[model samples]
Target chain A: MRSDLVDHVMTVFGAVVRGLVYSMLALPAILVVASSFTSSDTMSFPPTGLSLRWYKKAFDSEVFMSALWTSTYVAVLVSIIALAIGFAAAFAINRFSFRGKMFLQGLAFSPLIVPAVVLGIGLLQLFAWLDLTQTIYPLLLGHLVLAIPYVVRTVLASLSLHDQMLEQAAMNLRATPVQVIRRITLPLILPGLLSAAIFAFVTSFGNVTVSAFLTYGGNVTLPVQIFTYVNTSYDPVAAAVSTLMIIVTLAVILTVERLIGAERLA
Target chain B: MKQSVLNRRNVSVAVLLAPMVLLLTCFLVVPVLGLLRSSFLPGSEFLAGNGFSLTQYVRFFSDSYYSSVLMETFVDGLIVSVVCLVIGFPTGYSLARLSPSARRWRTMIVILPLTLSLVVVVFGWLIILGRNGLINSLFVRIGVFSSPKTLLFNRVAVTVVLVQQFLPFMILSVMSVVTQIHPVLEQAAANLRANRFATFRRVIVPLAMPGVLVGFNLVFVLSISAFITPRLIGGARVAMLGSLIYERIMSELNWPSGAAMAFVLFVSGLGFTAALNALAGSHLITKGRGNAL
Candidate 1:
């Protein structure tokens, strides 16, 4: 009986510690969202009366608005391009046993292993040498490289879990290869594809290191803009913008959870 | 007919691979090669001169300031990874022990910060750790302190923020492996007269080492290469190798020196990954994991 009590106490202690750790994990985002509603000019927590003035201010600013637009379009384009390439590579790797298959798979995932700072500087140097620094191509291409690995990983996971017998059955019914893929394969993997696109979108949207190097005049991304802003100033506008970013990210994550179940994502 | 079919299959495979191959080669391979080549050139002659030299490397090695930055970067990486492991192990273990529905909700909360941008998250830290911010005000109100302390722009703040940022990776890595360990083994250990702590230490921990190592290497690499967190939180008072490299390339326009330092950072990360793998060889506990790094 004494030992049972000891075990119970130990269990309670473990639960309390775990609770605190999880709270620490969630504390930063919570603080940022809370401070975004501060009524005062200075940023503070437990916020001196609630207000949305900072959100209005963030929307009113041309710099934040333009940067948001840039980030959105760039992320959309990157997600589409990454999906096309990642789908093809993942399909080929999953379906066919070609020579250099391992090489292709390794090369496809290699960007994840390389440090982002190196990739940033390398692209900056390459663009400067090619005299392409003035254009938006560097930012697009840099994010594309950073975003593709995630797309491949997600798509590959989706494809691997897919059943091949359905495709075989479709072929047995005199369906053409294209018809088999369109009618049988695509629908089965649509959840994975959507999730892969979301992964690509988030990776591209949240990027700062590579974008910092590649963003040319008048083309800064939202994250980079916020980074630069916070470096020099302490204000609630950053909090408002950060809250919006969190809301967008949370929405995407919820959509993914609805589509694929967040547990599977882990 | 068979030969023709084989040729068509080959052609289609090539077609599927062509775009990705082209993109990676043009943007990733060529640029990295150029960066490596330029690291051998002198800083002043980055654009004009083609001749190779070891001046940049010598400068990095011989200078105490640069070398200390590199050492500090590795030390910080070590501290973050260790702290992450200590905290993440229990959280992941408990998470693995949860019911399916409960685990799902808990995991979403755990990974919520990961979905948000690092800049946004760091801004949160800035608010909390700034003078007259959350902790300071609370402490002063309770008479724990006389005034708001200079909490931001220090190593402790940087370490705390980094641990917060990268803890999810370690948790997920541990949780994935822990879930795979059969419950029956724990039962069997208990049946053999072992206590809960004994079962955890002998059965669970050894089984979970592969995941622990993967999380360790991942957190270490990420923490060392981290740029924005250290720059924002550490400010000018603390310098990491990543910030130093950023300053050289972006601020000073010394491409060669920056490129060399970047290469050093990359190699050190790779070296540590290899060393960890070597240390955890193909034993029974690590056998089925298959090159997790």
Candidate 2:
């Protein structure tokens, strides 16, 4: 009984510690927004006054909004292409016995092992060779390389988790091959696909290295825009923009969870 | 019927593999090959003054500055990778054993930080670890310290942020391996009068070692190439290999020399990976760790 009591107290203490750590981790993100209200000339902590002027400046800006749109467009495209091709390859590897099975996986996974900076440099060189420098194509290609491994991993896990017996049963019932895929496999793996796509979007949306080489004067993404702007100037406007990004992201995640039931993902 | 079904499966596999093959060759293979060739090319007419030379390598190895930066980056990489595994294994195991419903919620917390971009995540850390940041503020609140703490612009800050950022990869990698170890195995061990720690130390750790190695390799490779994290968080104080390459490409515009630096980064990644693969293939780990593994 004494030992049981000790274990119980330890469990409670562990829970409290975990909560405290998580809260501390979360607080810095909140401070990014809260500090925007500071009326001081420098980025002083513990502000004395509050205002929405910085938020206003962030919204009224032309550069920030256009970059936001450009990122939005590219992220969506990356997600779609990455899922279609990555999921298909994952399905093939997991579902079939073939020569070069391990080789295919190794090939697909190597890009991720290549660091983003080196891969960025490589892409810049290749694109320059092809006379495609300073364009969205190279950036998109670089992101696609990074994204493929993730899509393959997630979709392959989901695909393998599903029982093969179902596919056999579907075929035994005279369902067409396409029908079996559409009805059984797609539904089973939809959550993984969604999660992978969402991740690809977020990753590309905030990309730096690959896009840094690829961005023309008029084609900035949110992160590149923020980095360049923040380099020369430190102000509440950058803070406001960051806060807005955080808010939008949280909203999307919660909305997606509510719509599809977040449990499906795990 | 068997023949027809086999034929159909073959066709399906080919169809599925097509796009991935093309994109991979274009983006992955071509570029790596390009990197190799570029690294070996002759220096510019200016640097070499008219001929091919081994001078790029002579410069890289001969310079203490470049060699030390490369070495520090690898050391930091090893530390970050090992730390993530140390923390991630238990967390991953807990996630795997939990009731499936509870796992969904837990996974959310695990993956949430990962979904944020590297820049955004580092930006968040900058605020907390910056001068007059949250840690210092809290320390003063409780009378732990009088002045702001020094966290950023140091080796410690780089490791902390890198560990936090890359931890999810470690967890996910280990989780994949751990989830494969059936609970029945553990239940059987319990039936034989083995204690929980004994079973885990002997049985679980051995089975989990491969995943740990994979996670280690992945994290080490990633950290070796990490630039933005070290740059932003460690400030100008860091001398990582990635920063060295950045200096050449961004500052000096010496593309050939930068290519040499990039090759060192590539070779370093490959060397670590080869060692990890050899470790995995040898199976000598089990013999050495017979007490725990």
Candidate 3:
């Protein structure tokens, strides 16, 4: 009898642990993804019925489209800007040892440790002062602040691995500084540059913390759109939108991985 | 063969850094300066000073309500990070032990969470944790409980969401640090007749503390400033620092107070991280010197 009781107790405790872990990992489907499958007039769990209506509804929604475009455009620009700035800094930091190298390194990597919301507040206050918060430019600029760190680290890793001896040999052969750069350094680090650009793209593309407080109506990113939607209503439409986000993001990540072999670049 | 080219190439370093210098100043340095200056701007009250004023600090630190909220925020942060470490450490160790190519693919999967927006995750949790959600339905079907438990807009929900969301990052950071520690350290301990528990506590734990510190700092900083997850999961019941700052600025229309709060948040986050980084750097420096012999 005691053994039976012990077995029962063990089974119950085991289930609890299983339930919690399962919910932790699998709840995304229950909460976000599965809800997209409701065949009802309102959001229901186990989705009362399965249909594609809400997905269609989300697609027809104008606000969702606007926010999607906003995020795409902002992410594209932020990636480009972060790549340029980080490329410059990485080139300088790796190619030559300077007096302020440590300080500059810290300055570049500072945002990696700072919280996004804090960064957002500071950027919002600064941009508001400059009367620029309402526009998409501030949104891009705010993302650039955060995205540059990724670019710097990625490019720096590649640059350090690059063969300085080859560049020196090129110079020995009478190649100009420009020629050496074009033939040697840039080609070697292009993979890193590409990886950095992808990282920047994804970071900016998915960011909501810095983008949230900084975003105004015209500057509403996709995440902001999802936020407002979830806040105001409860429905499978959110699930549909989330499904959309997941698909697009998965595609982008895979493409980036293929281009640079995500592991090597990271 | 070309010494003259070396001189010009050295000069080219300045050209490479110039644009970056300008960007860093505008995007980073200048904003911090602006935030600091705005923190001291005059309030409409009697107490106003240029040098130092506790108007904002005093208000937040004095009130028991905000103080409780602050304590809760830190506790939640600690819990989230520690929970991540517990799950992430094993996963990280496993990933580290994998062959290089396999490790790469595993890392890609682990980091997929990071590459997407947090908004999706929060929204995802809501459906799953809701009263009529999967867990509840499963419980009812199995006769575990007649009524579905309320998991939404609660502390448990908040912590769960944060942990699931940030687990990948904790794993990545811990894996990076653990990858550096030779597995032979643990093996040696095991060979010396130490049980797994002893080996873990004495050997694994000490080596992994650096990553633990880093992961803890990041998760803490992130948890402190997080507005949306708690907003979505915990609702208005939980007053975290992130929402407080938002309310102070947007609702109260107090920009100076908002700036002060933001500065405090910024400094505290940076300050603690700097302290941790200093410890890690000094450790590395000492190890470097020891290796020179």
Where does model 3 exceed 4 Å of error?
A1-31, A264-266, B1-11, B44-52, B271-293
- Top-scoring candidate (TM-score): 1
i-RMSD per candidate, Å: 1.9, 3.3, 5.1
Candidate 1 chain B worst ten-residue window by lDDT: B284-293
RMSD of each: 2.8, 3.9, 5.2
CAPRI tier of model 2 = acceptable
Instruction: List, residue by residue over B12-106, the lDDT tens digit for candidate 2.
Output: 89999999899989987897677656666567322233445667888889999888888899999989998888777766676677787777766
Docking class of 1: medium
Off by over 4 Å in 1: A1-13, B282-293
DockQ values, each candidate: 0.67, 0.43, 0.43
TM-score of chain B of 1: 0.93
Where's the lowest-lDDT run of ten residues in candidate 2 chain A?
A: A17-26
TM-score winner, 2 or 3: 3
Regions of candidate 2 where Cα sits further than 4 Å from its true position: A1-28, A36-49, A163-166, A173-175, A251-266, B1-12, B44-53, B140-145, B182-197, B280-293
lDDT of each: 0.88, 0.75, 0.77
Fold similarity of candidate 1's chain A to the true chain A, as a TM-score? 0.94
Candidate 2 global TM-score: 0.86
Q: Residue B29, candidate 2: how far off, in angstroms? A: 1.5
